[model samples]
Target: MAEEKQKKKGGCLKWGAIIIGVLILFGACAAAMTGGGEDTGDTSSDSNEAETTETATEESTEEETEEATEEVVEEESPDAGIGEQLDVGAMSYTVNEVTTASQVGPSAFPTTANETYVVIDLTVTNNGNEAVTVDSTYFKMIIDGATFDADSAASMSANQNENGEITNSFFLENLNPGSTMSGKIVFDVSQANADNPEKALQVQEGIFGTNSGTINLQ
Candidate 1:
């Protein structure tokens, strides 16, 4: 009976050890699974953050591009009209009147136009401190996207007095500061453009001055 009891006790001890080992293995597997899940979650979070940063950067670049385009469009000013003051470089001009004529000058020494004469009566003020030389080339007529130069011959006749006397004051003329001169600038244009309401004058500071302003002829 003693030996049998001892054998039974040994059998219980063996079974208990096997059950403890199985429990320990199960706990280890559970810990490994939990750690793996945490790693996967951290990786997902990092990828989301990277994507969000990239999206924000793209949006900022697009906004900047749109602002730059708008700036370029606002640089152009509107066109000026008759009797309005326009300044280009150092000269300020005002177109008082615009007329059309087939001929000009005295009857004894008159000059005829090829098509029609578009005359612009204007007053120019020497706004600068220094004197500037003025010429007929300082003015041009714009018609139908084309520019026509002043007709110097007809212009010379137009500048004459009633006695058929012409003065060189309007040619290579020197304008003093604070002084103003009024004259008619003539442009020979086609018959169609002479009556067109879309004509304008491109007035400049000098014959070749890059800075210019436009005056609506109508």
Candidate 2:
């Protein structure tokens, strides 16, 4: 009877140890699964945040592009009209009259055009503190977006005096402040160009054509 009791006690103790070992293994597996689930959730959250940042960056870039395009459009707006003074760096230009003619000057000493002549009578006022030089080359007629130089030979003939001599006003003439110089600038352009709606005359403060502004035509 004593031996049987000892065997029974040893059997119960061994079974209890095995059951405890099984419970410990189950706890370890559950802990590992919980840790792995936490890591996966963290990775998913990081991926969502990265996606949101990328989307915001794309939207910001698009908005900046739109603003840049708007600024460019505003910069290309139309210029001023005729009879209005366009002020540049140190001078101001005003178109008094615009006429188209097949020829200029007196009939005996006429300066005929190849197609037609666009005569622009304008006034340039010196607004600077010092003096500035004016020349015929500083003016250009823009017709249908095409630029045409002033007809120098025709201009000399057109600006002849009552005695049939040159006036030399549109040449290399020096002007002081509060002084105005008026002359006719002739462009030997085609009739189509003279009658174009998108016409403008560009006047520059120097011979290099820098610091210029335009006067639009009808």
Candidate 3:
């Protein structure tokens, strides 16, 4: 009976050891599974962070490109008239007299005996504060009923003769406020035309001083 009792105790002890080993193995497997799950979660979070950073960088680059394009368009646009604005003022002219005589020299006298000459004294006055320049090339002298060119009249006489139809060029560099300048114009008139000449000599539409003015040559 004692031997049988010993055998029963040994069998109970062996069963207890087997149960303990199974429990240890299950706990180890559970721990490994938990660690693997944690690693996967960390890797997923890192990937999401990288994607967000890339999206933000792309947005910033696109915004910069749009701003640069707008700046270039603004710089190339036209703004306003690119020239100096001229302010014109009032002008007046007066014809003093018309006469036949040479004041420059005797050598300038016309070689032709029938050719006569006349002088027209003009007084041009600027009433405005602005300076004015005139192109006197357009000036023409009218004697009797004939028109004479200004440049050709210069050859009539070497003397300063103010007779006949002639245009005079005077550079009144700057005609300040309320300033006046006097110049003489000579015209070549035939002796026959000068005889009993009703309107012996007259100046017409030869004075265009400025863009703005009622240029009266009377």
Best by TM-score: 2
Could you tell me the C-alpha RMSD of candidate 2 in Å? 3.6
Candidate order by decreasing lDDT: 1, 2, 3
- In candidate 1, stretches whose alpha carbon ends up further than 4 angstroms from where it belongs are 1-78, 167-169
> Residue-wise lDDT of candidate 3 within 139-194, one digit each (tens)?
45544456565433343333234453332335323456588766655555566554
1-218 in candidate 2: lDDT tens per residue? 99999999999999999999999999999999999999999999999999999999999999999999999986552356778888887888888888999998767879899999988888889999998888888888887667899998777677776578776558787888889978888899888898888889888777676577788866
lDDT per residue (tens digit) for residues 1-218 in model 1: 99999999999999999999999999999999999999999999999999999999999999999888888866543467999988877788899999999898888777899899998888889999999888887788888889999987787888887897776435678899988888878988888999999999988877676678789989
TM-score of model 3 relative to the true fold? 0.37
lDDT accuracy of residue 188 in candidate 3:
55
Model 3 CA deviation exceeding 4 Å by range? 1-89, 102-114, 143-145, 151-177, 200-218
Q: All candidates' TM-scores?
A: 0.72, 0.77, 0.37
